[model samples]
Target chain A: MKAVVTVTGTDRKGIIAQVSAFLSEKNINILDISQTIMRDRFAMIMVVDASECTEDLASLASSAAEMGKDIGMSVRVQHEDIFQAMHRV
Target chain B: MFNSTEVIETIDMIEKEHLDIRTVTMGISLLPCVRESAEQTAQAVYERVVRSAERLVPTVGQLSREYGIPIVNKRVSVTPVSLVTAAFPEQSPLVARALDRAADALGIDFLGGYSALVHKATADYEQKFLATIPEALAVTQKLCASVNVGSSRSGINMDAVRQMGGIVKQTAESTQGGMGCARLVAFCNAVEDNPFMAGAFHGVGEADRVINVGVSGPGVVQHALSFAPEADLTEAAEIIKRTAFKITRAGQLVAKEAARRLGVPFGVVDLSLAPTPARGDSVAHILEELGLEVVGGHGTTAALAMLNDAVKKGGVMASSRVGGLSGAFIPVSEDIGMIEAAERGAVTIDKLEAMTCVCSVGLDMIALPGDTPASTISAILADEAAIGMVNNKTTAVRVIPAPGKKVGDTVDFGGLLGRAPVMPVHCGSAEKFISRGGILPAPIHSFKN
Candidate 1:
């Protein structure tokens, strides 16, 4: 199943690189990603297919949270359906 | 994949400036579904709307997500229930219930058409529907109701206006202010092509099906203002024209896709920059950034006139089908900057009326002092309606008379209505003028071929 990972919090350098590296390590292919810095906060939404990832979403989410903690960010992983329901039409 | 500056501007506006197509409304004429039994009529109305608008919300939502443009409201406007219910006046309440149920089943945000155009004279059904407005409005959810009691062509219907004054009060009282008169709009010279809620209705002469779009870009205009603060009048006009063109283009694209998906004819695109309570997303702020401390200053009316005209010109050029009251709005409570200006005494009722002469609607979302006589409110509506009728334009009133609010008392309507300080009305009773019950004759231009 595909999932959407949204990372939001304080803006910091190399946060994107760190998150991308973690996803790549687990073989998660990022289908699409968009990021923006509004005022002093940074927000990123990434769509990724989780089937290719050897690690399940729980492991990925835990690792993502650790990565977020390292950079003072908040990371959330939601199924594609849920994301679409909330953000999509 | 689009490299053009205009495309980039459009994309950027939707992404960052909070610019989006506000509503994609399906105008379904409900006149054909009349029946002897109210229940059967209601069932027919429901089936027709469900069949017509079955894919409306889903299609709009899909397109909105795909394009990353937030389509905030998906709505439907039908033939005025007063006229439709006229076939069965005894079932007026049942008709209202039917509309409410139809809207609920379709998942539309608001269904408009509980309306009567009684500027000249009221039919039997119209009068009955008018009497049941408070009950109808209170009982229905997701159904907006409006009444056009007067127009310049028919002049002010003093009796209808008088009755409406009491109806509005009763409606508010019945709803316990939960709806806060938001779902009810009193209009003079109401337009047939209005795509916005609380006044939108599919006219009798309209086709069986049509799709109309209401596009909003207050934030985009505000962003454009930042680019040309010192630009001359011509330059400012060009900037506004260009921005409006891009915004209208977005609406055009959405409308085409929506109509294609729904298998219906694409109707008009209403280019009105309706502002919310969000920061940096107000039309009045755009005026303020254009060198006015407040939006109703000496130069404010001229500036708004230019902006309104330029927007129309640009929008008309972008879309072959442009209708509705396609102009800028300065509704005080809905716009943060306007609310602040009202608090600061920079915007007043008279000044707002002058602005409406150039802008789209009139005296929208304004809060008057509680004790201001109902006659004065009626006169305000009459005067504003006169402006619309004389100029051959659409004008409406959505004023709020907060029961206990006094002059200078700030009332926070919270979200959408924003927070507004009660602005003082011109101290005088318009009772004499409004009480003279006679139809103001139609304007000269109304006698067209």
Candidate 2:
């Protein structure tokens, strides 16, 4: 299974380092990363292989959201299937 | 990898738009639970529900966690109690209490099917059972009840309709804060596989066990329409169809997941855009967004008719089965925009009746003045039943005639049931018509055989 993690906030230091460290601690491999800055606001999205992750998907989602609060960024983790099911036929 | 836009859209729909699965209801058969005595039958009913739904709440939570979609409610609908307790209608409260206790024990949100199908006529024991409904509902917190008093095939039972008029009033007065009335529903052409409540029941035609999912996403549909400001009505309808397709597909996935894990058959994905008290999650707001100045305004019915049809057209293909009342619901108290419209004198009962001829439900969650007579309530039911009978659709009435309150005052049900202004009713009496106790004949079109 795979999941999408979204991070958005003002451009700050160590955003990637903090998020990647949290993911690695849970044994989740980041399959892809895309980051962009628009109008001075930083945004990054990560596709992670969650099949081997130690934490349950729901708790992982809540933990990622909590980590964002700690780092002053807004984060959300959602199952990849929801995106595919809604956007595709 | 899914695009950044897609991830953001899903997250925003949940956090900002209140997108969540309204309910994943389990329909359990109580036919096997009927026993020799009323007490033993009640006991079996409790045990059956408890055993069948022991893992319902936890299983739904696990599935929600795995899928990352918030499932709002876990409910159970059983065989109508009238059938189960036909031998001992006077002692039906025992069954109601047992069901109530089981729901509380399992932590289920609401349990329906404390119901009777008296569309054509009531039997001897059924009448005794109908008389017990007020007390049964007044005493139980989670037990929701409904009665089907008319159908396209059978026509309206004016006798049952008249009795329910008084029963609804008694149910309100006996309960605390008049909330019992909020949980009672009267229906025409009630479907056998609805997952929504105060109206859901496991019809005899259903399997021994099945999972029915009622998917809700008025916010998602409304948001999709917001981006197409430059589109014409035809284009707008297309947008709604596409959005409903997505919503029903999501429901289909969840329904399959839950049924697989629970070892039950997936019944249907009820493609109803049921709204809540939340700001953006309103069917009326969607209608208002479609260029209607107010929900009860002139074009409101046309816009709603298009929306309801577009939803079915888009959703019908997404699910293998779609049997519930699959259309947009305009429950007044449950939609903030609707509440404001009614409070500001922008909407009226007459307009709501006109709209129900096209929408999925009829005058749902509406509040009427306390002084309104019981016969008037029955008249409202007859009029709404007439619409469903002629059109061959499902329509229901769940009006709360607030006690000791008059027009313009609001009664707060709190939570998802929301608050509603006591909309005025016509002072003129329909007593003569309602007093004539007999069946309203089925429409000529219904004679097709």
Candidate 3:
């Protein structure tokens, strides 16, 4: 299963490093990563393979959201299918 | 991987535009649950729903979290209770209570199908069952009742239509502030697999259980049209079609996955631009975005017709199964724009009636004067039913005659039921028209053979 993880907030040091470390702890392999700035806010999108993660995607998504709150950012983890389904067809 | 702009657009629709799945309804057949007596049947009905939908709420919760979208409602529809309680039609309220209990137990939002189909003619048992609707709606918190009074093939049953008027009156008077009427709808050409509430029922022809999803994105469409303000009417419609395609694709994904996870057959994705009372999420606002000063202004019907057609055309390609009343709903109370329009005299019942000729449902969530006669209500239903019967579309009425309330006064039901200002009805009486009780014959066009 693949999921899209998004992080957006004021640009700061180590945003990618923090998110990547968290995904590594959960055994979710990052398949792709991209970062950019929009309207002076740092934004990152990561496509990750969640087949090896022990926790269910729902719980893992919530944990990621909680991690974001602690670091003063907005985070969301959604199945990649939702994006593909809406944007592709 | 999706481009950043596409991903951001999707997220913006969800976060800023209030785009969400309106409902993920499970249709369960209660025919197998009917037992010897009404008591036993009620017990069986309760147990059947509980057993069939035990995992529904949690599964929807997980799906909402995993997909990063809000699934606003989890509902269930079953074989119309009148059919299930046919043997003991007089005691149908027992089944109604049982269904409400089952809804409470399963923690679902609403349970529809406390209904009777008298489109062509009302049988003796069905007639008796229809009498239970008023008390059934009053006593139960989450039970929805619908009476299909007319159909394209069967025409209109004036007898049942007259009875429904009295029933709606009684339901309004019995429930607080006429709120119960919000959960009861009078339908013409009611579909078997509607995922929307106050009109959904699991048809006897359907599989034992199925998952149906209703997707709503009025705000998304409005946002899409915002960027195309300079576009012509053709360009505006193209924008709506493209937006509807995207919205229906998301719905198709949710419907398939929800059905797969719950081990139920996947039913249609009702691509209705159902609105909410929230400011940014009104279907009327979408029409206004298309250049109407207000939703009830001139050219409203044309705008709605184009919108309805474009939505269906786009949604049909995105999902193989698309059914229900899949068009823009113009419920006055549930939509902030419509509510404002009604309050300001920008819309009236007559205008709404004209609009229903092209849109999805008819005269929905409208509040009338407490003194408005039952005959008038029946007449309203008859007029709307005629539109559905002749046009071969679905039409419904969910008007509330708020007790002791008059025009300019609003009745607040709160939450998704929203608030409705008491709109004035015409002074003329329809008693003579409604009292002559018989069947309105099927339309000439219905004879397709």
Model 1 chain A TM-score equals: 0.83
List ranges where model 1 is wrong by over 4 Å.
Answer: A1-89, B4-8, B151-153, B178-180
User: What's the best-to-worst order under TM-score?
Assistant: 3, 2, 1
- lDDT string for model 2 (A15-82, tens) is 99999999999999999999987436687989899999998888998898899899999887777777
- The sequence of per-residue lDDT tens digits that candidate 3 reaches over residues B1-449 is 68888888898899999989999999999999889999999999999999999999999999999999999999999999889888999999999999999999999999999998999899899999999888999999999999999999989999999999999999999998888999999999999999999899999889999999999999999999999888999988889999999999999999999999999999999989999999999999989998999988899899999998898888888897999889989999999999999888998999999999999889899999998899999999999999999999999999999999998899898998788889999999999999999999989999998
| Every model's DockQ | 0.06, 0.61, 0.88
Models 1 onward score TM values of: 0.83, 0.97, 0.99
TM-score of chain A by itself in each prediction: 0.83, 0.91, 0.95
Q: Each candidate: RMSD to true structure?
A: 6.1, 1.4, 0.9
- Candidate 3 overall lDDT versus native: 0.93
Candidate 2 CAPRI category: medium
What local lDDT score does residue B306 receive in model 3, on the 0 to 100 scale? 94
Lowest lDDT sum, 10 consecutive residues, model 2 chain B, at B1-10
Stretches of model 2 off by over 4 angstroms after superposition: A37-41
Best by DockQ: 3
Error of 3 at B295 (Å): 1.4
